[model samples]
Target: MRPNPDAQSPGPCEAAPARKGGERPSRRLLLGLLGSTGMLAALPAAGQAPTSAPKASFGYADVVERARQLGERPFDADAARIPESLSQLSYDSYREIRLRRDKAFWRDGGSDFRLLPFHLGFLHDKPVQLHSVANGVALPIPFTTALFEYGKVPVPKGLSPSLGFAGFAVTTTLNHPTVQDEVISFLGASYFRLIGRGQRYGLSARSLALDIGGAYPEEFPFMRALWLEEPAPDATELVIYALLDSPSVAGAYRYVVRPGPTTHVDVTATIVPRKVIERIGIAPLTSMFQAGEGDLAQRSDFRPEIHDSDGLMMQAGSGEWIWRPLRNPRSLRIASFVDENPRGFGLMQRDRDFGNYQDLEAHYHARPGYWVEPQGEWGKGRIELIEIPTDNEAFDNIGACWTPEAPLPVGEASEFRYSLSALSTTGPLHPYAQTQHSFAGSDLEDGHAQGQGSKRFIVDFAGGDLAYHLGDPARVELAVSVTAGSVMTRILQPNPAAGGFRAIVDASLPDGQTGEMRIFLRARGRTLSETWTSSWTAPAAAAPPQPSE
Candidate 1:
């Protein structure tokens, strides 16, 4: 999401200021910047370049040194020279400035990819330095209004052609050989979005998440500068280098992006903090979850469901796979799953049926899920999911990121490496049956549906061996456990609607009691599904179970 132009300037990891009621930017106006493009013959000839190389030789090491040096000194917010006119442009006026495709960075030097810079305006008041690296030399990409087509807004008179660009997007022929598609974009502080062969932009990935869901206001780190390595004419992978800056930390990042059926980005981050950070999040994911089928009673919309992601999936250190269904809670809720050397985790949109969304324009069903696989053993941390209440679909209220257990020491470098996979679903990891849907309702007590005494949980599991044992409920067993109160009844039966087996759990809790429950399916001494877990809380003033008389 783009930052609010009037919001306080902070790090990208910080919680962004809430967008208020206004004529917000249109989806097409925001994403239409990147579209189909023809192939580039090659990188432009060196002699024809507009500017010479910078003093420092271009490489990953150079970026790391720059970040370290910057951290040693006090943070400077005004590093880039942005024009006052661009820094004060409104949302509608900013969108009017569109990049010219023919003047793209790698326009016809002979590469399979091209780069177009984002204009600095609206929420992007802070401009970032962009450079093109070729033959071990990094040359700056000078910004000019001539590169943009001001649709309705007039360009400011005497506008400098050297104002730094805000960010950039890359166009490539990953899916189609001749037709170029915008596969990845970098904008809005440290936020970036990536799409695979057939996926559209949905959730976003951040370089880091700092003090999110904490008592104090969060901080947002920004990518101040970036270097794009010139790719060969037949190169399949693109390498990018970035310098991250914030009031609390400074860092360098390298991303090796490979676009394919499941686009994979190998990331290496080296961070050094100016002050001690009590809580820092790594590999953060931001998404939206307005409503789903399980919460249909709470929604009054015509669409069956509306969300970018439906659940949070994690692989714990003990090799246990856990799936927690996401909800648009009535209030802010933060849940943490502690682990050491976690296998992986992600926010997934498992429900792919188009009918689930029914919106032809948004195509929410086609949103891609991003799973992060850590490259090395992270000592101890917690995967935290923060869900905030939101009534509309435009706001992103779901945030998932890994918080380190140990405090970050000042003036010391901390490093982490990971790879991200953009996929349709997280089905390959857990070959066993997986939970399809989960919902809660009033339980039937003595032929009466009692809403206060007992609660019923319905969980459906599909795929894997469940397909082999269809209609054979006798072969399936439900294993249930609870932290408090007792699981009075449990049953397993085939669900024709889900094309799988459904497990039902009915439990009774004492007043003022909250219980944590776990459920899974077992058939003939073999586990058949990933664990379904939830934290259930009873109403504060609910009456206790009455004595049988």
Candidate 2:
């Protein structure tokens, strides 16, 4: 689902969190992607059957040229390149149609991976060309029923065969011979999500984001064509070169995916902008945040929480590790953390307990936390977190990425390179206990809302040295402060059942003004726990509103 907009902001993902061992398309594509029927019908009526030499295929180098040439003109996306039959299917019907395992191309080629084209529908209507590199020549992967079995939907015969691919999914048969595991997928816009072993899909990674969180209409770039490097028959690794295009920029991307206990993917890119761009988000993540225990707004659901990611985890370049809980807000809010060559950042689903969510079909605990690490020194810039107001959890409301310290000059080419991992944990898989949950309400003796300027913040700390540090945690004072507000009361107590400590920090603002609060465990001022920071704005009656930090 989505994050709760009203909860406090979480920090950037820290370390390299990978799977710690704990954690569809459809139809009318029944035809091909490239329009082959038109070419066949145009051929002369000579008695000779319509026969032709291999058609020219595009390659990785071609994508570079396209980006360079695009810089001379405006960017344009051609989603219509796909046929009508493929783009009209619904979600349920699309899932029913799938590529047959036995008919996968290069079945006898000694390859461990299979290439399945995405069935166009819903958000993935853009068509992209797919190619296979084998004997030095790149060949097109054409569409045909041999690859998939259309369930109940009737086939529309003579529907000009267009043999193009919407996108591609790479599968690995490491553990199972008859079944293939979907390891990576590149579909819809410049968005391609991957996973490490044991990690379930949770967040998404995008090639580039332009004008994001801006007052103007947002721009979404799409991968128009992909040149898949032909894998050796015994190849366990795969490389995919892609062509990214949109109204603002054109770029090239290369992804090398290696699957295992901690599956990793190395991503390299060279971008050529069509024009000036002030806000360019690299390694952006999209997730849903609906509500949390802190949220007093009651709904019909009985579950305690509902969200895809809990907060943003970031390790600043200065070695300041921070965790900001996510929130589903009532208005648009953007948190920008200016930094130079920041260590790493990610949107993490840190609260991994089955009891946190009761939905069996939607396994919230299995979702992965993807973290991005820079390969080289990226110059001065800030990691930005954009939280959009959403009523339902289905829509992705959280966007986090690196916003360059300097703007990309107009009509000039810019280049950036970064390596990222899609993992399950928060990084280093450390044994450090963390905040299991954050709850809030008016501080009263018996859980009743009290009209006190001292707002209560209930925080649950789990994992660290809870057994030894529980009762009367000496030196563990509640360090609480609020900008545009004041701290009225504070207290830290023991939760024997939770086997952890709880802090009830009660604070308030002088008036209805924007307030920022930070709280965590600190003993002898040595920073006993990860810092929790958040920004909140008072209601109109409180004061002039300012978005959270």
Candidate 3:
């Protein structure tokens, strides 16, 4: 089955709030990667097959060098390579061609990890070359019909034996030491997703994003080839090397993935541009933001919320924590949070209550929040958040990436290294109070102090000292700011039920205009919470809410 774009199950554990329990590849051989001269020493021929003896040597240095050389030449769009039969297969028929579990690489060899390669069909007709490496030699994974269990679909008699893999899934005893479970997958373009000890695959990470949410058409880079390094018998971490190619750039990527309570992937990539890229994105992330507490009126579903992520959180280099609640906007919107050197940023799913989603099958609460922590100073870049209008939860319309202020120099290599954390919750990292939930609504009551067109923002903060020092919450003060419009009232009160504090901001909007608002809690001149930010846009016209199905 195609990876569910919006609904991947987390783990078996029930999610707790931030204040509570919620507070949470391979290598090819030498010649292919390193080129001819840089090959490692040849191994002694001992296997039965003399004709297939180890060829040239390969390593990460060779892959980077190859990428640099490839970028110097014009990109070759290798289309028409997929067989017509495979391309014409329907989605259902494609799903029928499943990889046989028993035939997985290393499964029967008593290794800690197993690899399953995907068949080329349906939307993934562009085959990606996959290689397995052991003892410094690389061997291309050969394609064979026997590798798959083709349910009822008939395989063409004359299909080429040279067909390559589309992508692959790696499995390990992630859930339990004795049980094999899918830990991560690399499929389709440059998209890949992973799960921690308890995380289900929710969002995906891209090796690089170019021209996303820009004026011109976007470019999608694909994993041209991949090398899977043979893991030791009892290895805990897996290594993968990939060559990425697109019209504008070519790249070499290395991922050191370790699955744990918080699965961490240490990513290192070097990008060599064929052309100057004005809008390049580093460590981009893709997720869904169909509707959340901030824009629940847009959704007519029975679930209180339907989203893979609810907010964008950034820890700026200035030590300020910024939280931007995601929205299902009426129009495509791009928000940029400029910074000189960002500490970190991520698309977070803060609300973990199952009641909020009520999706028994989807299990949105278990979806992990993906955080990007730069390994070094990335000097002068903006965290770009792109929100696209969507009518349903199926589309992954929310994107966050780091965009460098200056364009990438053509023919020169640029590198970025970062650690990706698949977090169950951000509470454990932040020492101060943080936003757990936020909601917005029109203040329509006539007797209310605020009149029509005035909006009320109710934000909840939990964890840290919020529950301790805020016992008399009246002592807490709400720090509020607005780019436009006027704030009518701002108040902070203790939420005994949540064991936290709630801050409310009431503001009157200008006719047919939009305004930016920011709010946070401070007690006795000390910052008590992350700054909660949102954009208020006046609807062109109001429509009656549709009844839930």
TM-score, per-candidate, Cα-based? 0.89, 0.80, 0.86
Tell me each candidate's RMSD, in Å, in order: 4.6, 9.2, 9.7
lDDT of each: 0.77, 0.64, 0.74
User: How should the candidates be ordered by lDDT, best one leading?
Assistant: 1, 3, 2
Q: What is the TM-score of candidate 1?
A: 0.89
Q: Model 3, residue 499: what's the lDDT?
A: 74
On TM-score, the stronger of 2 and 3 is: 3
Between 2 and 3, whose lDDT is larger?
A: 3
- Please report, as a residue range, the 10-residue window in candidate 2 with the lowest summed lDDT: 35-44
Q: In model 1, where do residues sit more than 4 Å from their true spots?
A: 1-22, 25-57, 159-162, 442-453, 496-499, 542-549
lDDT of 1 by residue, 146-241 (tens): 666778888767765456667778988867989777788787667787888888777778888778777766777888888999888878888999
Evaluated against the true structure, the overall lDDT of model 2 is: 0.64
Task: Give the Cα-based TM-score of candidate 3 against the true structure.
Answer: 0.86
Candidate 3 — which residues are off by over 4 angstroms? 1-57, 443-453, 539-549
Give the C-alpha lDDT of model 1.
Answer: 0.77
